[model samples]
Target: MHLPSRPRVATRPVQLAPRPPQLVGRDETVAELRERLLGSDVRPAVVAVHGLGGVGKTSLTLEYAYRLQQEYDLVWQLPAAEPAVLSAAFARLAALMGLRELGADAADPVDQVHAALAARTDPWLLIFDNVPEAEALLPFLPPVGPGHVLVTSRSGRWPRDQGLELPVLDLVSAARLLLSSSGQDDEVAAADVVSELGALPLALEQAAAYMSETGLALSEYLDLLHHQRAELLAQGQAWGYRERVASTWQFAFERLARTSPQAIALLRLLSCYAHEAIPSHLLLSPLERWAPRELFRADVQRRRAYGRIPGPPARLLRDVHPSVLVMMRALPRDTLRINAALTALRRHSLIGPPVDGAVTVHRLVQAVTLDQLSRRVQRRWREVAAVLVEAVLPDDPGQKARWPRYARLLPHIRTVLGPTSPGMDKTARYLGASGDYRTARSLFQEIAAALAAALGPEEGATLTARHELALWTGEAGDPTAARDQYVALLPVYERVLGPRHPHTLTTRHNLAQWTGRAGDPVAARDQYAALIPIRRWVSGPEHPDTLTTQANLAQWTGQAGDAAAARDQYATLLPVRERVLGAGHPATVTTREQLAHWTARARP
Candidate 1:
C-alpha cells in the first residue's frame, strides 16, 4: 500500500490507546517509571512493564504516555506481538517521516526503519504494546540513542533490571477506582469490593462496571462475586475493557494446556501451595539432600514422573513438576522444553514476572485454578508440596550460609512443620541466625519443654536447646538471664559430663566470655587463665579446643589491657592456625588480623 508522505524528518506526537481518565492509586509507580524512562543510568534501552495479566502493565504505561505527550518530539505505539506487526508499524512511521520513496526502493522495510531510527536526533518514545518476548524485539529496536522504548508484556523473560512489575492498587487507590467507576462515594462498599477482588485491577474494573451497569450496591457486588465469581467475570462491559479477569486466564490456561500440559499441571499444583514466590525450585527442580539422601531418593522414579525428571546422582535436573518440588533453576541450557512451558505460560499472563530470584504466580490465578481442579487432586497435590518442602529444608539452619536458604523456605516450612515438629528446633536456629533472637529464644524455650517431656530433662537435645536459648537470650539483651542460664546449666554439664568434658568446658568458656563482654575483663582473664590448663589437660595441648582456649585467653588478656602479651599469644597462635587450618582459611586470616590489631595497639 502506497502512503502519502509528510514533510521530511518531521516529528509526530506520542500515539497510544486512550488511558482511563481517573487512574487511581498508581501515582508513585507512574513517577518511578517516568524516572526510569528519563533517568541517566545504566538501564536497558527498552524497559518492559511486566506482570500477571490484568495487573495493569499496559494501563500504567498508557496513562504515562497520555499524560506526558508533550515531553517527546516523536512517539509511536505498536501491537508488538509478532515481528511482522513491528515491521508494519516501522513502515507506517517511515511513511510518516516522508521516506516513502526510499522505503519503496528499499529491499527490507525493517532495515529502512532502522536507518530512519539511526538518523533521528529528536527525543522520541516507542511503546511496544503486548510484547510476547523482549528478546525478539532487540533486532528492530532503535540502537541506544535519542529515544526510549517502553514494552508491556506478560513475560518476565526480559532482563530483570529492565522490567517493572506493575502491581495492583492499594486499598485507597482501589477504592478510588471502584467509587469513581461506579460514580459514587460509597466508601464502605468500595472497601468490600477491593477486599473481595484482592485489589486486582482487572477484577476491580469488571466488578465496578457490573455495579454501574446493573445498579447493584457494593454489598450486592461482593455477594455476587462470592456466589458467582465466574458469572461476574464472564459478564462483558460496555467500556473499553473487553475481558474479565477470570476469562482472560481461563483462555490462557486452555491455550497453555494445548502445547504444554506440564505448565497447566504445574499451575494446578501451585494453586495448592501458598501462592506468590512459592519457591520455583519446589515446582521445577529437586534439592540435594544432606541427611536423608536415601529417604529422599526412595521414590526417585515416582519423583521423575511427577516432580523432577531425574538424572544420574551427580547430574542436576533442571525442571521439576510442582507436585515434586518448586523453585526456579536458572540453567541457560535447561530452557529447551521446561522453559518453553514457562514461556507458554508467560505468553498467557498466568504467572507474574520473576523478581528477587524467584517467579511468582498471582494469588488470584492460583485461587481460580484451584477452584477448577477436583478436591481429591487438590488434596494429593497439597501433600506433595508439603513433602517437597520438608525434604528440601536444610539440615542445619543455624549456619550463617543457610540463612538465605532458610528465608526462601520459611513460608513453605510453616505449611509443613508446626511447633511440635522435630524440625522446629532447626527453624528456631534459623530465626536466631537471621537476628530474630527473641523469637528464636521463645521457640527454643517451647521446644526445650517439649524435649524435656519427650526425652528426659537432661537428654542431649533438651540440654542443647536450653544452652542455645541462654546464648540467644544474651543476644536478645539480658546478660543477667544468660548468666543465670549458664550458671544453672554449668552444674548439670559438670555433674553429667564431668568438669573437663568438652561440653562442660564450653559452658565455662561461654560464662567467662560473657563476663568479659559484660565489662569485667579482669575476671574474664582470670577465668580464661584457669580454664586454659584444664582444656590443655583434657584435650591435648595441640587439640583444636585447647587452641581455641589459648586464642580466647589472648583476646581476654588484651581486653584486660595487656596488648604486649596478647600480641605474643596471637603471634604464637598464627603458626599453629596456619598449620592446622591453611593460611588462606578464614580463621587463620582472622588470627593474622587480630595480631596486626594488637601490634598496632602495643606500639608507641
Candidate 2:
C-alpha cells in the first residue's frame, strides 16, 4: 500500500454517538466537546481534556472515544508517559491498521504512526492517555489528515484552540456517582456524603468504595470521611479503580517542591492569616527576605520597571484548597513557622489570582489552615496592658475612650503581666481615667488589699490605691470619703508627678472643686488662686483650661466678698478672650456676659 505523502484533511465531519457505561455527571462537557469535534469550521483540529489528577479526565476521554469508534477505521489509546512503551503500543495499533511494516524501527515509531494515520483513506480517531507533559507528544501527534486526536492531560496548555478544562463533579453529580457505585438507595444520605468529600469525583469514588467494603450507610460513611481525612491520607488507599486523591496530591506536592520551593513556603504562611483574599504584599514581604539575591533584585527591578507600587501588609490570607491549606498549617511551631508556611503557599497555586491589587485566600481555607496551625503552633499571647497603658494614658480623651475594652480584659491582662507587676496600677489608672469608676474602684480596692498583704499600707501603690478608693467613694456620693481620698492622693500626685506637673495641678483643682461643692468658697478661693499662675505657666494663658482656671478663680473671689477684685479680674479676661477668640466666639461672648454682670454689681 502506498502511504499518502501529505497528512489527510477530512472534508466530511465525523458524527460521534453517545456511548454506554454512559459517562455520568459530565453530560454538558461531553456534548460540548463532541459538538466542537464535529463542527466543520474547527481548524488545527484537536480536543484536550485536562483537570487535577483522578478528576475523570481519562474516563471522559474513553467514553467519548468509544462513542466515535464507528466513525474512524482505526482507534488507538496511546500511553504518553513512557516513550518506548507508547511506541510498542502504537506498533501493535499499526499492525491492526494493516501497516505491519510500520513497527520495525523503534527509533521513529511516532513518525511511522503519523504516516499511517495520514495515508488512511478512511477517517480515524486516536486517544492519547495520561499525557501529563505536552512537549513529549508533540512529535508523536498525527499529521493533519482525515483523522482526529483526543488528548487527556493534567496540563492545560495544548494546541491553543484545542483545550478543554474539565472541572470536578458538582454536588449533584458527585452524589449520583456515589449512589450508583455504592448501590446505595438513600439519595439524601448520598448528597450528604458528596458534600463532606468536597463534591470531587475522585473523593466520591473513594467514599463509595469505603461504603461498599463496610456496608455502611451513606450518613455513617460521611461521618467516617469527616473524621478520617488525615487518616485516609495516611493509609494511602485506593478506591475502586481510582488511585487515592491524597496520593495525587502528594505527587503534585513533590513536583512543586522539586520545581518551586518558594511557592510552597508562601502557601504555608498564608494559612495563618484570617482573610480569604490576601494582598500580594503578604507574599512580597517574605520574598524580599527569603528569595535568592539575584531573583529578589530582578523581582524588585521588574516591579519598579512596571511602575507597580506595593501596598500595605495584608490583614488576611485565604486558600482555594482547604486540604492544601491544612497541610501548610501543619508545619512545626517556631518563630519562623508562619513565615515558612506562607512561602509554601506561594510556591503552590493554592492562592488564587490577584483581585483589586489584593491577594486573598478563601475564608473556608483560612479556617481549616488556622485549625491546623493551632495544632502545631502554641500561640504566644503578649501582655498588652503595659503597652496599652502607654498608648492610652496621655491625657488624651480619644485614647482614654479605648480603655473600656482593655479594662474588660483585666483578668487576662493580669496573667500576661504577672500578678505583681506595676502594670496592674497603670491598668487601674486607665480604668479610673476612662470613667469606669465602679470597676476601677473594685480593682483599686483589690490592688490595695493585695499590696497591703505583700508590702505595707504605706507602699506607693497601696497609698495610690487608697487615694483612688477615696475618689470613687466620693463619686459614689460620700463627700467625706471623697475628701479623704483627695487628701490621700494629693501627696502621692505631688510626690510622683511633682507639685508643678499637670497631674498634680489636676488633683489640686479636684480638691478645690470638692471643697467649694462642700460649702467653703473661702478655702476654694485660696486653692483657685494657687492654681491660676501654675495653670498659666504650664498650660499657657490662652489655653481653654487655663482660661477656665482664671474664670473659676474670679468666681471664688466674688464669692469670698471681693467683688471689686473679681470685677477687675473678669474685665481683664474679657479683652484676653476677645483677643484670643473672636468677639462672636462662645468663650468671648461668655466673658463679656460675665464682665457685664460683675460691672453691674460694681455700681452698688
Query: Which of the numbered candidates is closest to the native, going by highest lDDT?
Result: 1
**lDDT string, candidate 2, 68-129, tens digits:** 66676765666675677677767765655556665466345556667866776776777777
Give per-residue CA lDDT, model 1, range 1-604, as digits (tens).
0111233343454456665666778888889888887784642256888877777777777777777868877766777867876677777767666667544746566676667666677667788887777778787776656777888877667776688877778888888888888777779978987877778888777777777778888887778878887557676462445566666567667777786776776666556665547666443444333322332444354334322222553343222244333222221113355456566666666766545535666667876787676666566566555545656567778788878877876765665544545446678889998899998899889877876776667866667877888888888988778877888999998888888888889899988887777778888889889998898888888788888888889999998999999999999999999998889988789899999999999997
Candidate 2 residue runs with Cα over 4 Å from true position: 1-22, 40-44, 101-103, 185-192, 234-242, 267-282, 289-604
Least accurate stretch of 10 residues (summed lDDT) in model 2?
378-387
| Candidate 2 CA-lDDT value | 0.59
lDDT of 1 at 344: 67
- Please give each candidate's TM-score: 0.55, 0.49
Candidate 1 regions with alpha-carbon error over 4 angstroms: 1-14, 41-44, 101-107, 184-189, 250-261, 280-359, 371-380, 386-604
